[model samples]
Target: MITLFGVGCLVFLVVCALVVARTRDLLAATVVFAAYSLVMALVWQQLQSPDVAITEAALGAGITSLLFLLAIGRTRRTEDEEG
Candidate 1:
């Protein structure tokens, strides 16, 4: 029997992917993208690749999300000024 935690994580990953695709706000999408990283890390842990999973958590959930949010912040000003 598949653990519910595993199933929920898998479902969450799919949902996050869809959220990222459908979200209109850049900040919201970046947050969902970060959620995708976290879900991927959980999947990696389930697969026994703790090292890779840790790296993904740091890069995908941490660094990449911060970078995207920062970029969005920078660009928001430009968009606002133009509009």
Candidate 2:
């Protein structure tokens, strides 16, 4: 029962996942990962799971991305101090 829009979202999600995995930059990877999460949330919504979609949007795309960014920043600072 998948529509064209749903298929498109699936494709986009896969592409984003691949990009996140292949990217060398941590920040870029994190951003791509967040995008993937957002797409996933959309898919969940289309599937009629509003609660799961909201949770994914809030945690996966929001707090998780913020945490990754902060961690990356801290790691960069540590590397700078060591080198």
Candidate 3:
């Protein structure tokens, strides 16, 4: 029952995962992780779980990204003052 689009999304998910893992910059990794979460939300929608998709989109992509950005901003300022 797997379609081509599903396969493509899966491949993209793997690539995003690798990029997030290899990236050393926290901000860059957070952006990529957000993208990965959005794609995962799409995958969940494709799998017919609209509730999970909505949750992932809201919590994983939206709130988590915002929280990570806030944390990065605070830590960067602290590091700058110390260095």
Candidate 4:
């Protein structure tokens, strides 16, 4: 049963990756990419890999996201529509 769950998470991760790829909005794509990392981290935790989970949380969910957001700052934002 757990194997099925792991498989499902893998499939969902793939879908999230596709979503990130297909999105034209940089911010939206970044958010989707973060979701992909978070889900992957959970999957790793469930598979008895706490070290991977911690690394994913610290790097994937934290530093990587901050860096991506910083990079995405070069793009226009919804708030800019008012100007």
Query: Could you say which candidate leads in lDDT?
Result: 3
| Clash totals, every prediction | 0, 0, 0, 0
Candidate lDDT scores, in order, read 0.87, 0.89, 0.91, 0.83
For residues 1-83, write the lDDT of model 1, one tens digit per residue: 46888899999999999988766677888988998999899899988899999999999999999999889977862224333
TM per candidate: 0.84, 0.89, 0.89, 0.78
- Native-to-model Cα distance after best TM-score fit, residue 76 in candidate 1, in Å: 2.6
lDDT of 4 at 13: 98
Q: Give candidate 4's root-mean-square deviation (CA, Å).
A: 5.0
| Model 1 CA lDDT for position 69 | 84
- Candidate 3 clashing pairs, residues 3+ apart or interchain: none
Error (Å) of candidate 4 at residue 25 is 1.0
Which is the winner by TM-score between candidate 3 and candidate 4?
Answer: 3
Which of the two, 2 or 4, has more lDDT?
2
lDDT of 2: 0.89
